[model samples]
Target: MLRAELAGVFRRRRTLGLLAGLAGLPVIAGLALYFSGSSHGHGPVFLDQVTHNGVFLALVGLVVSGQLFLPLAVSVVAGDSIAGEAAVGTLRYILTRPVRRRRLLVSKLVAIVAFAVVAALVVAASGLVTGAVLFPLGRVTTLSGFTIGLPQGVARIAAAAAVVGLSMAGLAAVGLFVSTLTEAPMGAMAATAAVFIVSLVMEGIPQLSILEPYLMTTHWMAFTDLFRVPISWTGIERDLGTQAVWGLLAGLAAWARFGTSDVTS
Candidate 1:
């Protein structure tokens, strides 16, 4: 069933389209920077330096895109999981095949995570390649104003991307739980996205500062701290830990509710 779900996800035109759209982000952003690196009022002023190193492009892509596009792309796939099947009137048929609901739910979660990993890799790979060709490659300067060797920089970029990818797992689990609640994939997608929106809004409100650390999306950009000298693990660890907690808790919630829920199509 996992294999079948994998094939279903990877072979779908809509899934391919989502990935393709994600890949294009690097191209568009890189080109915009390439042609207008010196233009005033164009992206963050700090971003002008990205034109100097390909590694910076990957960081920039992760920083900018991770805020919205990447999460939204993953949300669509995860949010559609069981809900998509139900909307098509195939949920009852699949259940009749003697497959346990838990097994099916596991399959969907696996497929969603696999899809997210691939999407993250694609974004990182495209950003690196595009940045390499358009900019230059060498040691990368960290946000702390310290420079690191090329190899280490590459390693940190990969690690940063990985952590960012893992953060999305929390969002995926939220989407999966939402998927289990409704047959409408669209509603699941919207509800899952609302998690991010609400988090960001809550974070921006000064009154909510005390509660910010608990939101799953709070530590998302913590991956940026990985580029620092000696490899700052505090933020990265906290972010990964927060994401894991959210994913695990949401997965359990979904399982508990879905274990015996009605599945009429």
Candidate 2:
């Protein structure tokens, strides 16, 4: 079932388009920074230092793309998973087969996870290559008030990329649940994106600080801890825990809805 799901999801032109757009971001960012000369001490967090160490480009790309594009890309796939199939009348047929609805949802969710992993790698790989080509690669100065060697920096970049990639999976689950609520894939996409946008906005408000810790997006940037000297696991641990909670709850909701909902298509 998972194999079949992978085959169908990857075969779509939309999937290719999402990956292409993702792969292009690092090129654009890397080029602009490459020609910009000095760091000027400006731009997204950690981005200004890219000229110093190419490995930082990987971190910078994750930071830049994580803003909106990353979630938007995965949401596009997760948002479309079930609703898109139903929109075209294939969902009913699939349900009629021996494939349990829960199993189907699991397969689709797994596929989304696979896509998210690939997307993160694309950003990290492209950014690293572009940064190396355009600037020097060496030891990295980290936010944790310490310096790390080239190999260590690369390890942190890979680890950070993995965490950031998984962080978006919670949103993917949210999108999956939303997809089950409607037959319009675009609607699901918009709704899923709206949830993140709203959480981000609310996260910025001081009055809402009480609710901040519980918000699904609250700990997203905690991946930055990888650059820390002692490597504070406190926030990253909380971040991954929050994402898991969100995904599990959302997945359960999706299963409940899909299992009980009528399929009239």
- lDDT tens readout by residue for model 2, 30-145: 78888886568877788878877777888888887876888899888998999999999999889888679999999999899788878888888888898898889988898966
Off by over 4 Å in 1: 39-46
Q: Summarize candidate 1's per-residue lDDT along 101-146 as a digit string, tens digits.
A: 9898888888887887688777878888998889889888887888
Give the best candidate by lDDT: 2
Per-model TM values vs. the true structure: 0.94, 0.96
**lDDT (Cα, 0-100) at 132 in candidate 2:** 92
